[model samples]
Target: MMFRRTAFTVGLLALASSMYSHAEKVEWSQGSGQSDGIVVSDGANNNARTAYLSISSAISVPAIKKTQEEVSTLKRELAEVQRNAEEMKRQLSTQQNQAASGLKDSSANLSKEIDDLKRENQSLKSALDDVKRQQSQTASSGSSNSSNVSREMDGLKRSVEELSRENDKLSSSNDRLSQRLNDMDRSLSSLESKVK
Candidate 1:
């Protein structure tokens, strides 16, 4: 009889240990209310025992509330960060579009100016060629005619020299503009990389 009692006590202790371990995994009830009961039976004597386990002490209301508040605060912070990122994206897009538009306008204006200069240069060359032909034809006619032709040729030469200087200046301006455009492009690329 003593041996049977000892074996029953060991089985009860093992069952209680298993129940305790499982109860630890259970979600804490919001309210500290009642102690849960479990019944155990010893097969030999056909007797039953009741075990009561209290889980209310393990539930911490203040800790749970603090954790919830922290989560809410983190969520708000994350939302604010997202909003800021979107605003930055929008601003960057606007800046890039404005820069591109300005670049296109400047390039178009430069192209038109270069075209106009080329046309003017061609016209001046044609005029100078005509003057040369007339001078050659009248060379043997007289000294007065030759002198007039010489003066006209000198004027044409001076005009040609001025056009050459103007063309050189325009070329230099075009090179500088191209360099500025390259610099702007690199700056935009750097900005984009930093954003990414």
Candidate 2:
């Protein structure tokens, strides 16, 4: 996934650079009131008169009619394009809103999951502490009156060792859970960047 994202970004950058390099710079001539902007041509060919027209006076009517029709067609196409653009904008906005809503929901869920995990961790810690306290009380009480102090010390030591083992197991499990959560976060972030 990471490799794919990197490749895509590289490809897009290369395409953008190529497009920029290939772009043409159009420089218009300064000539004004002309064909492409030239004014006074007393010859047969001029911007104002077409080759097909018989009389110069006929120029205005046919040309004007044609211009009006072209304008009408262009206006219709423009309206259609504008309507499509508006529809696209609306769709984009709706999709963005949905994405935001989904993000918010996921964030809330992640926060809740973290909180729940923390609460469970605290509960486990409290339970472990209580067990240690109970063991200490039991060992101390028996040691005060018993002749087998060595055996009591050995038992206490064994209990402490067992508690240490439990703590190590819990720690490893927590570490694994944390790594899994980090991996999930990375995946989600990668997905979000791609969507953008």
Candidate 3:
């Protein structure tokens, strides 16, 4: 019985091999003018054991082309957006640097002016003290010279008041510039976060 089973299996394999050898792949044209199909046929029979496989029907060429075009356009749009973002970043950096430079220069100038004003104020105060000492020493001489000393003292007081007012104005300006710098920093940070 084992020998008979082996002989039957060998016969079946031989038949399969013969059929496989006789199989032919032919191009099948469609009546609707579509793409050609592959028809695997057995040469032993014209109508038996035929397989029709249409690759174009399974995958539409026009759909594939449209998808490819859409992907290309999307890539181009993404690249353009990236370029615009980079340009905006560069401009923002330039503006930030320029603003910082201007602020530094203005702050330096204001500081120098304040220092100069303080020194001048100190000099004026010293001169007024000297005049007071002179007035005290010569008070025994006359009333007219005392009046002149008082007028000089009054003029020095007015000058001191004016310098104080100007110093206050510069301090206020420096405060405003500092506030602007803080605001710009916050804005730049927010923009950088959004870009990331």
Cα lDDT tens digits, model 3, 102-126, are 6566656655665665566566566
| TM value for model 3 | 0.54
lDDT of each: 0.62, 0.59, 0.61
Q: Rank the candidates by lDDT, best first.
A: 1, 3, 2
Q: Output the TM-score of candidate 1.
A: 0.53
Query: Please, what are the lDDT tens digits per residue for candidate 2 over residues 5-124?
Result: 556655654554454443332222324433332112223232232111112232356778999999999999999999999999888777766775675566566656666666766766
Q: How accurate is candidate 1 locally (lDDT)?
A: 0.62
Q: After superposition, how far is residue 109 of candidate 2 from its true place, in Å?
A: 1.3
- List ranges where model 3 is wrong by over 4 Å: 1-35, 38-55, 140-196
Question: What are the per-model C-alpha RMSD values against the true structure?
Answer: 10.4, 23.3, 10.0
Kindly report which residue stretches of model 2 are placed more than 4 angstroms away from their true locations once superposed.
1-57, 143-196
Candidate ranking (TM-score, best to worst): 3, 1, 2
lDDT of 1 by residue, 1-196 (tens): 5566556666765777675553422232322354542343333444433464443344557888999999999999999999999999899887866766675666566566656656765665666567566656556456676667688767766765675676566567656666665665666566555545
